[model samples]
Target: MDILMGEPEQSLEKEIEADLTIGDLTVHEDRNEVMHFLHPVVYMTNIKGLYKKDDVLETKWTSYITIFRSNVYLSIFGVSVLVSILFVVIARSANRLHRGLDESALVVWLDASWFTLAALAKQGVDYHSQGLSGRFIVVSWWIFAIIMSTAYGANLISQLSVHKEQKPFHNLAELIRSEDYSFGLIEPSITSMIFQNTKSGSVKQAWSVLRERAKTNPEVLDANPANHFKMVDSGKYCYLGSNYYLEAYQGKDCTLKMMDSPVSWQHLAFGMPKGSPLIDEFERTLFILNQIGFVADRRKKWFKTRDPEECRSSASVKPVNFADIQIAFYLLATGTLFSIMSLLSEIVIASTKKR
Candidate 1:
């Protein structure tokens, strides 16, 4: 029996095969570089992404932030519906008071509104004739903008002037512009900022810190902060998280909360290893989260149980002013406009391509 291995007396290190090594990196004999997944999941998340046992694949990084643009506008949609009805009533009353409505006029007005929204949204336009749905789209969009401008102006005045039990939103700008406490956040990077006076730690900042620290303290980046919240518990680290709401300080389990309204907003989503067959699984996770009303229900539960210390600290706050709802409305409108414009641009491109 001839048994052969390393030459007799060869060091154990000689028997080890390294995947990759940089000075002291000393990667294991049979593994690729590993990254710590900092958010909760049913399984391990790989930066290289989960690939076949033998095949290595390059993957695109996708966001795990849930998109809330639709929901914010949905709130406005309900309000818009109500306002539309009120406007219809006001127009009817004005016609009755100023010039009697023949009931026939009311019918024409209703049809016009239909054409208007479709046109404003850049969908085919009101006048289908001359293929001028294109021109009608532009015209309708301007009209809608004028209408929204008027509505926003009027609301601004009311929100500023009317001090009811509901509290006038008169102090938002100052609040957002005011200095407040800062804390850790989870994300590839935080995307929004309230003007400039606040400092909520973001993934970008965290990543920068992580990168700096990695050179001297490499163990942390490999430590999974997602599955375990201890790093942040140590109060020195931030969790690059998938769910922004989890960082809320007002919740029952809100280990952290915004010192002020979020300096930025991020969409919660499961980042996939771009082009992974797990796209279906990722979508399922989003669906399940929404079905669970994870954010909404959590907000309700957290809002009511805010810490007294936090409330007191933030108590001198002027009111739930511009920084909160107003900015939300702005974002909501901006997002809608952006989506509409993108759709229109696509149509124009398609039309041009066809030509």
Candidate 2:
């Protein structure tokens, strides 16, 4: 058997049709009409998006608060304020009935607010409610605090333990919708052909976008797959291609990632002349190899990394660094600075009164 390097212009299907060479090509309905394909060598393989890892946004300092929805934060805030107001009303009424409590209304309000906040933080306050109504409200607030704090703690730990990275686009539709990314696949390839021929959907829309872009920038529909990969490495482009090819490229460049969602699924098989007699024989051989685990071994050897643990160490959980929770320290610093300013202001006011 002679091996020949296929070209974009002279595709493997054309060569096989001319009885020159049998080549492995993605089995498509159009190609199936002209060439005979052996039983699919690769099944359910898909086209995935490839992009640079640097393009993904890293976990921000505000991730602790941002992980919860806006509604959740609003609900917590609303409940805390409501509880503080209730506590203040009940405590003031009790103090009025029994003149032993000398705290002013403003002091009571501040203490109530602080108590509610401290309970939410799972901390204790020195002040306690004297009346039964006030004590009942305190117990209810404690229960609410326990539930909210437990949920917050669980969610925060789960989110922070895994370093969150947000990709620019999750799937092809998002990639198409995004104005920031320019995506292209190799021209004359099965994936590009599918995108071009599809009737209506994101695939067709993507093709239209590429076609329009190609009118000005010819690289948008280039025949060379290397150009697409190079564009992807620059962090401004996305490349849509076969999963197998993308995975092979990813193995070489750790910075490159294949999106989990696939764009399309296609069967991969060897192409032969329309009336090829070896299809049956090849199918039998493939079946036998599959049963003997030969095919599985070869696939693992080529497509998978030798040491997956080493390749994925960057994604694994490690001890939390200062950078992960620096927002808390920032809040503390801001509070201390405000307290110093308040003290200075009070000192100035007292000296002015004495003068």
Candidate 3:
């Protein structure tokens, strides 16, 4: 089979009867449709995404400090404080019912705080409520503790275990909206023409930006076929082109990845003349080629080797390193030092008073 490359519209201009063609032929508004399927318009970005072979979808790793700042912990703290204050107030008001429990106001407050802390930690405390109001508060606190603990546990497990993919852009829509990477298509290309004349709002928006960039920096809008892949490799630009070309360009570079979704869908099929007798035979052969792994073999030959081990599942439980909690330990040390100094000062003052 002889392979010829020409624009789909050119098929109408040139009256050569052919059996098949290879390219994504777009259907114009006049109901003219291209009859073969090959590849789609895939967006490219230099942003790397992390993924595990076991995971169906990729996710991003979040910092522990970020997890601590979540709404769940904030709600737990707020509710615990309110409940603690109520317990203290009720304990003092019904003081006669509880005999020889606590002597000072500070002791009562300390007990109240400790009670909430123990409940929040899901640990059982030795102390029990003496009065009816105190018992009701205790029961309510336990219920709150149970719900909050379960939720926090589930959230924490998901946060720490799930593998996250870190990519610059997730979809075509995001690529257009993002300011991090500059993107465009080659001039006089079919892709550029599609965006230039599209009625879709997003396409128009992207085209406007490209047009502006072209006015200032024409290099950004250059249509050189080779420059698209080169710019992507340099990590400064995002190139919009056929996934077929992109796949070839990727070769052995693991650093490059196509966007998960594409901006548009294109059909690739063998070009044939109108009412060609071999159209049915060619279509069947195409399907057979795909089923027999011919397409897979070709792809493997051109692209990088797909290795499961490269992005395999990792340990869910990460050991807490010193850097993870250094801030917390520093604060604790500061507090302990201040308390020791305060105790020493109090002892010295008492000695002076006695003298």
Report the number of the highest-TM-score candidate. Answer: 2
Per-model lDDT: 0.36, 0.69, 0.58
| TM per candidate | 0.22, 0.64, 0.53
- The best candidate by lDDT is 2
State how far residue 93 of model 3 sits from its true place (Å). 11
* Model 3 Cα lDDT, one tens digit per residue, 193-213: 767778878778888988898
Q: Write the per-residue lDDT of candidate 2 for residues 1-355, one digit (tens) a residue.
A: 4434452226543643343233436777777676676664744478888888763445777767665566656756776776676667667766654444656778888999998898889998876766555656666666666666766786677667765566777888888888888888888788888887777588888898999999999997888989888898888788888887877777756677777778888776655557766667777887888889887787677566434554563453333433444453344335434534544454466468669
What is residue 70's positional error in candidate 3, in angstroms?
A: 5.0
List residue ranges in candidate 3 displaced over 4 A: 1-17, 23-65, 68-71, 78-106, 114-179, 275-355
Candidate 1 C-alpha lDDT tens digits along 86-194: 3344344444433544445467457546654554344563432112232333343445545444544555444444432321111223222323311222221221122
lDDT of 3 at 209: 87
Clash count for each candidate, listed in order shown: 15, 0, 9
For model 3, state the Cα shift of residue 335 in Å.
Answer: 32
